[model samples]
Target: MDGLRLENEIEGEKTILMLKERRPIRHIVNIPKTRNTFCKGTKCRKHTPHKVTQYKAGKASLFAQGKRRYDRKQSGYGGQTKPVFHKKAKTTKKIVLRLECTVCKYKMQLPLKRCKHFELGGDKKTKGAALVF
Candidate 1:
């Protein structure tokens, strides 16, 4: 049987298999005209508007979901959260510099120096956040 595949972008990289959940046929939806995609023609070197060539429908693993027993949780395994504890509680990760995304307008903290692809440019702020030296 054909299973759906899910992919997402994480930290400027594509992340696959974020989560798996089963759903009926209607849940699997595809954007129309996605099959035939064309690049956003632009003369700019890297500023070109991106284009979609193909669309992959995300899916959940049936084998993995079926193995889970929701009914048994009420007896001895029942709990509000999976793992029965805060085994998966999200923790704040340490970062170098904190800034807001210009595109998303969301507060984001990132390492000061690591990846070479990114150039450590000056802040968009004029006075406060902007570094003096």
Candidate 2:
């Protein structure tokens, strides 16, 4: 049967299994440029306005201990010393928001759920408005 399975048992019992249908959900998220939240900075410990931005990882340093050790092990005419990784499973990355306190200029990071579409400081949505092309 379509999307259905039937199993027969030896004890004269029959079972019916129904497979769940999967649906893809597409949602677009929009965030504002500024936020009002509590700041944990030493100077500003109360609620304050924060500037919001997307957090990006900095460049990796070649002089790090791990990099140095790897480079030293790789130089001596030996093939790949370590196994390369190829088993990546996740398709989307978690979004991180960087919030900076306006008064103290202190920065903090907040992680968000994974989403297919992400928008920062995009246009605001109005109620009862038609979709524009």
Q: Each prediction's TM-score against the native?
A: 0.18, 0.78
> Which candidate leads the pack in TM-score?
2
Model 1 poorest ten-residue lDDT run: 27-36
**Model 2: runs farther than 4 Å from truth?**
1-26
> What is each predicted model's overall lDDT from 0 to 1?
0.37, 0.89
lDDT of 2 by residue, 1-133 (tens): 3465656676787776678665443467788999999999999999999999999999999999999999999997879999899999977788899999999999999998777898999999999999988
lDDT (tens digit, per residue) of candidate 1 on 1-133: 3556788898899977645555332322222211222222343222222222222235965456543554444447535544555577433322244333233333323343222132233223445565567
In each prediction, how many residue pairs overlap at the backbone (N, C-alpha, C within less than 3 A)? 4, 0
**Residue-level error in angstroms, candidate 1, position 92:** 1.5
RMSD of 1: 21.3
